[model samples]
Target: MQVLTINGQRRELDVDPDMPLLWAIRDVLELTGTKFGCGQALCGACTVMVDGMPARSCQTSVGDAAGKPIVTIEGVDGKVAQAVQAAWIKLDVPQCGYCQSGQIISAVGLLSQNRKPNDDEIDAAMSGNLCRCATYHRIRGAIHEAARMLEA
Candidate 1:
């Protein structure tokens, strides 16, 4: 059994100790917003926040995540993800939209630390997320727009 603080709620999950935190979130908790892109962490599809820092959940152990505060896309709200979501909607950033959750989470992580990021910074921060739609430019644009909205 593991006790996790998720979306500001304490959730106790009776799961395998070795199961990936992504599985625990998706299987046990039924929080499907956090996706599984590549199990090896090569893709950032399973991104989530561990104590406000973006983490690749596919590579994270459930036991290791036990007792840690976790936040998923479904948990996202308020001023934190609002601007990003708004920017995303306003910019029509998603094509296929499969990678948007991870991209958004990564953007949130980047924006949390650096409000103003250059193209290189955006590239560096959003490097891991693989979008088959090839919407990198739009994603970058949404990040910038989100930053501007947050600043306003």
Candidate 2:
């Protein structure tokens, strides 16, 4: 039995230590918001917060994450996350939506570090997350909007 704090809840999951945190989140805990894009972590679809920093769930092992707090898209909260969500909705950032959750997670991470990010900063921060629908423009706009909303 392995106990991990996920989304502010202590969850005891009976699983292998080598299992990816993505599997623990989706298969075990049933939180499917974080996606599986590239298992190699090249794509940011499996992004989540581990100890308040963005981490690729696909590459993170359950054992390594045992004592840290993990926050999935389903459990994202606070002003920065809320602002990002609202901006995502207001800007209509999703096309197919498969990558939105990860995009949102990455956005939250970026805004948490720098409340105001320029286009270059946004590009640098969001470069890992890929949207097959190619909504990069809208995503950038949403990030900017989220930043403004955070300031307000």
Candidate 3:
């Protein structure tokens, strides 16, 4: 049995250590907030926080994440995360809402370190995340808005 600290709770999962964290998160923990877009880590739909930094859970190993605190969309909520979520809502960035959780999670990670990320920086940070609804423009706007909200 392997132990993982997820969403502020500790749980034991009976699975392989090499199992992708996305599987452990969705199947073992039963927290479906984090999504499975591209299981190969091409998409950021499976993005989650590992010790407050954004990581691709689809490629991250459950053993590597052992004893580490994992925060999915359901676990995020500092001022930065809250501001990002609020900005996303204000901008209506999610037409499908399937990718919004990951988008928001990525935005939170970016905003936590950089108070003001320019277009290039935003692109660099958000490059891995894809939205089928093609809400890129609105996503950029929301990130900028969230930056301002964080500063305010």
Candidate 4:
């Protein structure tokens, strides 16, 4: 059995250690917020936080995630998360809304470390995440707005 802290809750899972964390999170735990975009980890749809750092759940092995605190979109909290969610809402960042959860997860991770990120930094931080709806402009704008909200 592999033990993990998910969304601030302790869980004991009986699954293959080599199984992808995305499956474990979505299938086992039934937390459907984290998505699977590309099984190869090329996309950020499965993005989650391990120890407050952005990690691609599709590529992250369940064994590798053991002992680390994992935070998914459903578990996002605190000021940074609130600010990001507010900014996303204000900017209407999502079109189809399929990638919004992962995007929001990445944004929360970015804002947690860097209160204010420049355009380059924002681009770099968000590079791995792709929006099929082509909401890049709104995503960038939301990040800046989230930063400003954090500052206030």
Candidate 5:
């Protein structure tokens, strides 16, 4: 049995240690918000906050994630997360919506550390996340809007 603190809940999962955290999160824990994009971690679709830093769940092992705080889109809350969610909705950032959860997780992670990020910074931070709809412009705008909301 492996104990994982996910989304503020202590879940004791009966699974292999080598299993990817994504599977543990999605298949075992039933939190389907975190996606499985590129299993190699090139795509940020599986992004989740592991100890407050954005980590690719596809590449992260359940063993590696043990004892660390994992935050998925389902449980992501706080000032920054709320602002990002609001900004995303207000800006209409989702296209197909497949990648929005991962995008939101990454955005919340970035904004948690940096209250204000410029275009270049936003792009750099969000570069790993791929939006097939090519909604990069709207994503950036939402991040900026989220930042603005944070300031107010």
Candidate 6:
């Protein structure tokens, strides 16, 4: 058994230490917001915030995630998160919406560190996240809007 601080709550999970954090979050914890895409950590669909930094849950082991603060789409809060969500809504950034949660989490992670990110930075930060609907343009727009909202 390992204790994980998830969404500001302590969760005790009895699973293999080598189990991917994504499974622990989705299968064990039933927090399905973190998706499973490509499963090799190449796709950003399984992104989650571990200790306030975006991490690929599919590649992260539960043991490595132990004792760290894990935040999923359900647990995202605060000014940055709120701004990102608001901007996402305002810009209509989702097409199929399957990957939006991971996209949102990645956006929040980027915005948390750099409030104002240029297009290059946004692209670099979001490069790992792949949207099947090809909503990259809107995603970029939303991130910029989120930064603007943060400025306000």
Q: In candidate 1, what are the lDDT values of residues 8-93, reduced to their tens digit?
A: 99988888878999998998889998888889988899999888888999999988888788889988776858999999999999
Range of the 10 consecutive residues with the lowest summed lDDT in candidate 2: 48-57
Say which prediction, candidate 2 or candidate 3, comes out ahead on lDDT.
2
Question: 1 or 3, which is superior by lDDT?
Answer: 3
- Model 1 weakest lDDT span, ten residues long: 74-83
Segments of candidate 5 deviating more than 4 angstroms: none
My TM-score estimates for the predictions, one after another, are 0.96, 0.97, 0.96, 0.99, 0.98, 0.98
TM-score, cand. 3 vs. native: 0.96
- TM-score between candidate 4 and the true structure: 0.99
Candidate 3 lDDT: 0.92
Each candidate's lDDT (Cα)? Answer: 0.89, 0.95, 0.92, 0.94, 0.94, 0.94
User: Per-residue error at 119 for model 3, in Å?
Assistant: 0.8
lDDT of 5 at 36: 90
Q: What would the per-residue lDDT of candidate 6 be over residues 37-80, giving only the tens digit for each residue? A: 99998889999999989999999999999999999999999999
Q: Model 3, residue 106: what's the lDDT? A: 93
> How does model 2 score by TM-score?
0.97
> Per-residue lDDT for 1-152 in model 2, tens only?
88899999999999998899999999999999999998999989999999988899999999999989999999999999999999999999998999998999999999999999999999999998999999999999999999999889
Model 5 / residue 22 / CA error / Å:
0.2
User: Which 10-residue span in candidate 4 carries the lowest summed lDDT?
Assistant: 34-43
Judge candidate 2 against the unseen true structure and give its global Cα lDDT, from 0 to 1.
0.95
Q: Per-residue lDDT for 18 in model 6? A: 94
